[model samples]
Target chain A: MELVELLKTVELFEGLTQAQLQRLAEISEPARYDKDTVIFEQGQQGDRLYIVGSGEVVVRVGEDPRSARTQVYLGRGQIFGEMALLDGGPRSATTVCSRNGTQVYGVSREAFTNLCKSDTAIGYVVMRNMAHDLSFKLRHHNLTLV
Target chain B: MIYKVSYVVSGGRHPGAIMNEYERPQLGDRVEIGDKVFEVTEVLEMTPPRGDFQYLHVTVRLVDENENP
Candidate 1:
């Protein structure tokens, strides 16, 4: 799918207008990762959010790269690294390509922040969507602990 | 109510496992299958029943506890 169409399917971009998505698409850079490739490591400085374009990516947590545990598998339309983008914090988890031809679209913090600053409407919608996504994950995580 | 759940370990050799899904498997749920402990990291999909409205089908991905801990 086209980047805009793919962004439309992402829960984080849900409710965003086509024009907004197009702007986002323009800022995004396409990337590819081979199977078993470590995309980013936990604790690394994070400045980008990645949207899965195709293939699978796994999120892991732990200090050891050789044995870090998997935390989740993200497929098409899913996103990662938004926490760092929003907070300017280190990466919370490691992400790796789980499939042979994993593809993603990445948006840097600078570009996104600039976009948000230029357009508060896009900023509001994007932030709200991110909040919703994070809240849903937190809720589910809490439920599992109960 | 008890529900059956199946999960696949991302980038691992294990073929995954089936277990009861009581609490609705969420990210970070520690699950045990045989001697291996896995952490629930993602919910792949959930399928509701067709006609009679029975159990829902859920697929999840997990990673070994050794890696997560």
Candidate 2:
């Protein structure tokens, strides 16, 4: 599906208009990957965020660098490791090809910024979506605290 | 405020890596020489690199940020 259409389906972007989604699509680009490739390493500087188009990728989290444990698998249309792009910090996780192969769509920090500058609404929507997702996950995990 | 960028090269050097962070990309990051459009997708702070002149590395995915296809 087209990126705009894909956005419509994603809950995070559910409320965005087609025009906004199209504009977002225009600013971003597509790419492919092979099996066992290191998409990004921990502590490595990063700028762009990614959306998985095909295949699966693993999200390795933790500060230990060496003994870091992976959290989960990301499938098609699912985004991973974008928080680093939004929040100016080292990559929070190391993303690697989980399957024999993996593919994803990425947006550079600059591109996303430019797009946001041109249209703050888009940026707000994206950030809000990301925050919402994080909040939900945190709340769900917080259930253990109680 | 800093900026970042990611590009796609049908055939070029430094083509596959995803740009997850960087200070900002120069014009080269946005405009490709030929048969390519190295579009910038984000803007971030300029972080210092750990080692040498080559400080930070950019991130990009197989699919473009604006991937509509």
Candidate 3:
């Protein structure tokens, strides 16, 4: 899929216009990871958000890094590390490349912040979408605990 | 068409995922999700297909660990 098209599918960029998605595509960097690669460690500071472009990655949340438990598997169009970008806090989970040749588009928080300041619309829409994502995850988590 | 399947486990310990798959998932199919394997029990169409993407909500049950292992 085209880069801008993929960006449009991302939940965070759901309501963005074509021009806005094009602007985001301009700042996104492509990254590739091999199988079993640790994309980010839990508690690590993250400055960029990743959208899975191809293949898959896993999110592991627990005290032990080697914990077999995996919280979520992210595939094409799924974004991770957005919470860190929004809250400026350490990563709440570790992300690993579970499939070989996993690819992602990385958007730096600094770049996104600048874009948001320039175009308030992008910021507003994405922030709202992020809220929806957080709510969905929280509900799923609470349901799991029940 | 790439179907974006969100496999939610029904009364299971493992979390499900949103994945891009070429083939559609069917009920009673045992698939590995997260670190554990599960059997698909139900499939719901959350949204109709848009362009090349289709979204599906799948409910899966954990297969007996001993049976799968």
- Candidate with best lDDT: 3
Residue A38, candidate 1: alpha-carbon lDDT: 89
Estimate how well candidate 1 is docked, as a DockQ score: 0.07
Q: How high is each candidate's interface RMSD, in Å?
A: 9.3, 17.4, 3.6
Strongest candidate by DockQ:
3
True contacts kept of each: 0.00, 0.00, 0.45
TM-score of chain A of each: 0.93, 0.84, 0.91
Instruction: Give Cα-based local distance difference scores for all models.
Output: 0.69, 0.57, 0.80
- Candidate 3, residue A89: Cα displacement in angstroms equals 0.9
Per-residue lDDT of B61 in model 3: 83
How do all the candidates rank in terms of DockQ, highest first?
3, 1, 2
lDDT-based ranking: 3, 1, 2
- Taking the tens digit of each residue's C-alpha lDDT, what string does model 2 give over B1-69? 212121232322332222222234643345321122445443333234212111122222233547553
Model 2 over residues A1-146: C-alpha lDDT tens digits? 77776555444454578898888778667877776687998888988888876676766677675787645445555576677887889887788875565667788989889888988998887888777556533432232133
TM-score of chain B of 2: 0.28
- Compared with the true structure, what per-residue lDDT tens digits does model 1 show for residues B1-69? 333344555555553443334366677777654335677666654344322111322333455345745
Candidate 2 local lDDT, residue A3: 72
Q: Write the per-residue lDDT of candidate 1 for residues A1-146, one digit (tens) a residue.
A: 77887776566776678899999999999999888898998999999999888777777788898887656556666678999998999999998887777889999999998999988888998888788557545543333333
